[model samples]
Each structure stands twice: as structure tokens, then as C-alpha cells.
Target: MSLRRGAAHGAAWNFATAVGERSIGFAVLAILVRHITLADVGLIAIASALSEIGRMITTGGSGEQVVASPGDRTVEAGAFWAQFILAAAIAGLLFVAAPVLARAYGAPALSWVTRVLSVNIILGTFLVVPSARLVQNFGFRALSLMSLGSTILGGTVALALVFSGRGLDALIAQRIVGITFYAAAASITARWYPPAFPSLAAIGRALRFNIPMMGAAFVDYVAATGYVVLIGIRMPVAAVGEFRIAQRLAEVLRELTVFPASKVFLPVFVAVRDDPDRRFAVARSLVDVLAIGSLAAAAVAGAVAKPVVVLMFGVRWASSAPVFAALSLIVPAAAVYAFVNPMLTALRRPVLVSVFAAINAASTALAAWFAAPEGLLILAWTLAARGLLTAILLLPALSIGIGRPAWPLLRLFTAPFIALIAARVAAAALVPVLVQQSGLGIVAMFSQLAVGGIIAASVFLGTLALLAPRRIGTLLGQLTSAFRRVPVVAEPVG
Candidate 1:
């Protein structure tokens, strides 16, 4: 079949895989929270963030290079060797930083936790090329199955560890297991393996393309999770845990709604890169769907953020609700990256993307530095507002990539913005009618969340349908056809 058909199939499988795996992942979090203390959560959050920064830096450009080159054995070997080398360097850095982190947080456990995770990152290096190869060939079906298996197996191991009174290990072990499964499974599925030796010249070529992406990815991750690091430093331990939960929930909504399309955007963009008119047209369509879907998801999540947080993580995490809402408000704005970055990469504009991410990262870090000491809610809103600012700042780059003025892109979010506001307003308006007390029972909170999410979403769709029927119709059309079954990747580009 055609690349268009393959992309739709990839989107379908990716969406399904995201839903299934994240559903289990969510359950794992909900379970872990009950048994795990806030202090332990804070410790792990800091460690995870640090190690993950390394992963983001090393893998960002290398994998994209693999996908861009397609079936180039030399490039694949170079990417793997490059990622592995970076992982090693980062692991060494983590080892050195471990003590500093422990002292900074007054959590001695972090030193060992950070050390263990350093090793995990090293093991994780093996997966990058295989994973990217799957994407190169549009083999998302195999990747999807591997993802589900990874999540399930990892979650199982985690729960067992937790029940056995090892909550910290549970959390870390889950990631390790998941990575191991996916790395091995993807390699098998793609029938690709690393060569016996490295290619210095190919590595140089890959680095030229990937170095800017490394900075972009690193800064972009810092923009999102930098608050946790700031909180761990400036605020109380419990606040770190609360913010982590809030971030996790916001991420869940993002993974479900925006990322499915994002997973396929690179390949799609690459396929159409040579045709400006088709490229811009495709970019426009995806951006609209991304904006609207992201807005709707964020609206509903924001509307029910309170009850959902309470019910899911227990009343202890109720404080995270406001934080989630603050973060949720920026979903449409932040979702811009999911589309824009991939588009920029396909357009050979990684440096521009780096600038975009750097500005956001700097602004967010500045905002957090001031806001963290004030309070969690203050920090959250500060970061949230910065997310919108990032979107505003990114429009010029987006316009340049598509060879259009910024107004057309700016106008795309108008209806979705309206719908998002309407949904939140409608949900808030129903609270007094539905909730009588803060100390309500579990069933009551469940009812509130269910009713609130449903009505909020309904309002969003109704507003969109009323305001822009044709646009809404097109978005719906994509969703409906996005599920037609087909082979994940029939052939490779090379």
C-alpha cells in the first residue's frame, strides 16, 4: 500500500498501544502511590529526571538520523555507537553527580539510586537504533506489540517488588525491565543488529545532523521536568511528590492524545518533504487536529483534575490537582512541539528547533527559580504561562518552515481555544451542584469525575461543532479513518 495508508495504520497501532500500555502504567502508578511514601517518590523523581536528561540528549538526533537515512548500515552503526558512547559519558557524569544530588536533597538514598539508574541508561543505549529502524520502516505494529509486552512485564515485576516491600526498587526495576524487553523485541522485529565495529566517518556525519537535536531534546525535557528539580531544591519533599504526580497526569493526557499522531509525523513529514504544497497542507491538517484534540483532552482533564487526582492517588495527592489543572491549560500550546519539532527535523531545520527549545527551557527555569519558593501552585502557573509563551515564540519558525505568514497558523487554534475555555467553564459551573463536601466518599468522587469529564468533553465538542463545523468535520474524518487496518510498514525507504 501507499505511505499514506501505512502512516494511518502506524497511527492506529501507536494510538492503541499508547492507550493499552499507559492504562496499565497508570494503574501501576496508582498502586505504587498508596504504598510508596512521598519522600521516596521525591528521591526517585530527581534521579529519574537526571538520568532521563541524558537519554533525551543522546537519542534525539541519532534516531532521527537513522530514520532520515533509511537502510544505511553505516549510519545505523554510527548512531548506535554514538548513542552508546554518549550514554557512557552521561552515566559517568551521573555517578559524579550522585553525591551532589544526595546532598542537595538531603536524601542519601539518591546517590545509590542515581548510580543504579546510570547503569539502566547504559543498557538502554542498545535500543535506540532498533527502535528507530522500526520507525524507518513504519513497523509500528511490531513495535506496538513490543511496547505492550514491555509495559505489562515491567509493571508485573514492579507490583511484585512493591508487594514485597521494595517500593523504590519497584519503580526503578520497572523501567529496566521495560527497556530490556523493548530493546530485544524491537531488534528481533526489525531483524537489525549492530555491526561488529564502529565507523568514525559515519559517526561524524550522524553527529553533524544530530548534535543540534541533542541540545533541543535536552532543553525541551528540562523545560517540562525542570520544575521538579527546582522543587526538590527550593520546596519541601512532599511538594516534589505532589508535583511529580501532577506532571505524570498531564503526561498521560499528552501521551494518549498528541503522541499517537506525533509517533507518525516524522515519517509522514519526510515522505512529503520534497513537495512544499503537499508538505504545508499536511502540516496544516495535523496541526489543527493536534490543537483541537489536545485542547479537548486538556480541558476535560483540567475540569476533573481534582476528583481524578483524589480518587486515583488517594486524598493525600489532592494538592496535585491544582498543579495538574495549571499544566493542563497549556496542553494545546505545548502540543505544538509534537508537530513542529518533527516537521522541522524533516525540513532539515534542527538548529531552529534547538533555539525554540532553548528559549522555553531558559524561561521556564527562570520562572521556576522565582516561583518554587513562593508555592507549588505559583510555580505551576508560572510554568504553564511559559508554555503558552513558547507557542507564541515558535510561530515564526513554524511559518518559515511552511513558507507562510504566522497568521494562518495563529488562526488555526481559535476555535479550539474557545472550546477549551467553554469546557472548563461548563465543568466548573457544575461543581456546586454535584459536590456538597470536600470529605466525600470514593464513589462520590468517581461520580463527580465521570460526570464532569463527560460534560466538559461534550461542551468542547459542541462548541467546536457550532463554531467551525467544517474544520471539526475534517478532524473527525481523520480520526475515523486513522483506524483502518493495514500492515505497519510494507517496505523500507532504502
Candidate 2:
């Protein structure tokens, strides 16, 4: 299959997977929130935050290597065993340290929660190579189906457990079941098995490539979840829960937009790594689409956060609304920022990626610390500010990687930023009127969100169309044409 066609198929499947999984996951969360208390939610958040380090270590850079070098059975075998060992080690470490982490957070429940969730690291080890093989072969359809099925089944189980009042244990069970299903499905779909042993040389090479990537991933993990840890330490557990929910909602927007794009585009970029002009063009198009889509989603999500939170989690979670709103501003910045790792990795610049990750980690830690005392809202705002700064920090590197000036790359953000501003204005003017007209029930909240979202979206899109008619037209035409083409499945790149 042609690269364009392959990309289209991959993107389509990734989008489907993201939409399906997130939808089911969100439903499960909404239900769980009704059953779980603020402290229960907060405890889970702390557990997740602590487990993220292990998760990062287990699956970090290994999959990228597999995807990038699919022909190397030796490397794949090496990565498989290496990751399995690492995952087991990390799980053990987490088990041993759970008490310490629990003590640090002053939440005794966190010890067991972290220990239970730690098992997922071992499951994640089984996932890395199979998933990479699927992506390498452009087997997105199978991957998407597996993801959707696993999410639905696990979500069902989670809902049942939550209804039975399992609380944090329910969340832990949901994660384990979902990942176990995905790993099993991926292994079956890939039709590959690990060898008895991997060559030392192959393991060395894999480790060399993966270790820095792991470093970057580890620091990036810290950057992403450090605030939650700090909040758990310095603030109340309920505050951590609120921040976590807000982050989750904002991340759902991202998962639906930028996350899938990142997954799709990374392999695509790696495939075309040798073709500079093509790579740059593809990167530019991706940036344009993500910028517009994520900003639009963020704007609408920010505007409707209050009503949505109230409706989804009831009035008790209403406190998370402003945090969600604050984090929404980071969406566009994150969209732009997503390209950095993929593009640099494609160029075989792990060192540069690591540097960027370090910078981001330091900045995020500092920002979170500075804002921790102020409250969740301020911490969230700081997160948004740090996102923008991270994006700015990445521009010079992106310009260097893509062979484009920083100015044009910066210009790509202008339309979306302007459109977001307009959307916010429209929402501000429309929301109060809708609230007054509809009163304050669930139905009213839904009506207000629906109407307000539509108006805001229309304004944003209309403004963008006016500002960049030609670009929008070209993008639409490309998308339409891509959709019409017959998908061609290809063998994994060797």
C-alpha cells in the first residue's frame, strides 16, 4: 500500500479505537463517581500517580523500537524479555514501596491500591511488542476492535464492581482486566511468540536505543503526574481527586483528538523519515488538523465544563469544573507539543527528545510547586501556563527537525487561538441565557450544553473558515479523497 493510504487506514482505526475506548471509559467513570466518594477517588488518583512511574518503565521506549525496526526479530525478542524483566522488577519495587508511598500521602489505603495496580505493569510488558507489531503492519482495524471490545467488557465489569461498592478496587480491577484483554488480543492478532532467549548484542542495542527514550518517558511521566503527587502531599485527598477528574476530562478531549494523531503520525513519520520534504508536509498537515480540532474541542469543553461536570458526577464534583476550564487552555498547546517526540524520534534524535523532556519535567515540577499552596485552580492554571511554555520551548527544536522556520510554525496557532477566543465569547454570552431559560435539572444542563456547544462551535468554525478558507478547503478535500480510497493492508516494515 501507498504511504498515504496506509496513514489514512491507520488514522481511521486509531480514531475509532480512541473514540470507542474513551466513550466506554467515560461512562464507567461517570458511574463510578456516583458510587465512589471523593476520598476514594483521591486514593485511586494517588495510586495511579505512583504506578505511572512503573508503567512508564515497563513499556516506555521498547515499543517504538519494535515499530521502527520490525524486521529485527532479534531486537524484538530482546525488547520483549528486557521489558518483561523490567516490568517484573518495577512491580516488585512498587509492592515494596507501597507502604512508603502510603505513608508519604498519609493514606493507608493507598498502599494496597498501589500494590494491586502495580500488577498492570507486568501486563503492560506483554502488550508492548504485539501492539508495535500491529502498528508496524498497519493492522489498525484489528487493534481498534480489540481496544473497543476490551474497553466495553472491562467497563461492564467495573460498573458491576462499583455498583457492588468495590470503590478503588473496582477501578483497579477495570484497569487490569482491560489491559489483560488487550495484551491477549494483540498477541493473538500478531501471531508471534517470544523466543527462549535473546542475544546479548541485540539486547544491548535495544537497551541503548530504549534507555534514553525511557529516560525521556520517565521524566515526562513525572512532568505529567507530578502535580497530583504534590497535591496529595500538600493538599487534601479530595483536592487530588478533584484535580484528577478535571485532568481526566481535559485528557478525554485530548485522547479524542491529539493522542490518536500522535499514535498514527509517529509510525507514519518514521516510515517517511528518509523523505524530508514529505515528512515536513505531513507534519505540517498534522499540526494544522490537530491545532484546529483540539482548540475547538477545548473551547467547547471549557465552556460547558460546569454543566457537564454537574450532570456527569452530580453537584459534589462541581468543584472540578473550574479546574477543567483552566486545563482546557492547555489543549492547543498540547496538540502542538505532541509532535515533538514523534518527529524527533523519527529523526533518531532520542538525545534531543530527552533534553526536551527534562526541560518540561523541571518546568512542570517548579510550576506545580509554586502553585500548590494556592489551590487546585491555581495549580491547574499553572499547568496550562507550563504547557504553553513547553510548546514554545519545542519550537526551535521542531523548526530544526522539520526544516521550517519557527515563525510559520508559530503562525499555525494563530487562527485556532483567535477562534477559541471567539468561541469563549459566544459561550459567555449564550450560557447565562440558556441557564435562565432551561432552569437547572439534568435535562436543562444537557440542553444548555448542546445549544451552547453548537453555537460556540459554529462561531469558531465560521471564524476559521473566513480566516483560512483555502487551507480549510484543501484539508477537507484531502480528507474526503483519503476516505474514498480503498484501504490497502501492508506487511510490517522490515
- Residue-level lDDT for 18 in candidate 2: 91
Q: Which pairs of residues collide in model 1?
A: none
Candidate 2 segments whose C-alpha is farther than 4 A from its true place = 437-439, 486-494
lDDT of 2 by residue, 1-494 (tens): 77777777778788878987887788889989888888888898878777777888667789888888868888899888888888888899999999998888889988889999888888888888988998888888988899898898888888888778777778888888998999999998899776678778777887888888888888877776645776688788877888889988887888887877677777888887888887777777777778788888988888788888888888888889889988888887678768878888888888888888888788888888778789989889988988888888878778867877755666788887898889988898987876665545787788778887888898889988888766676666666666666643221111
The residue-by-residue lDDT of candidate 1 on 138-223, one tens digit each, is: 88998899999999999999999999999999999988898888888888887867776675887787778888999998888888
TM-score of each: 0.95, 0.95
User: What's the count of clashing pairs in each model shown?
Assistant: 0, 0
RMSD of 2: 3.7
RMSD of each: 3.9, 3.7
The CA lDDT of each predicted structure is: 0.83, 0.81
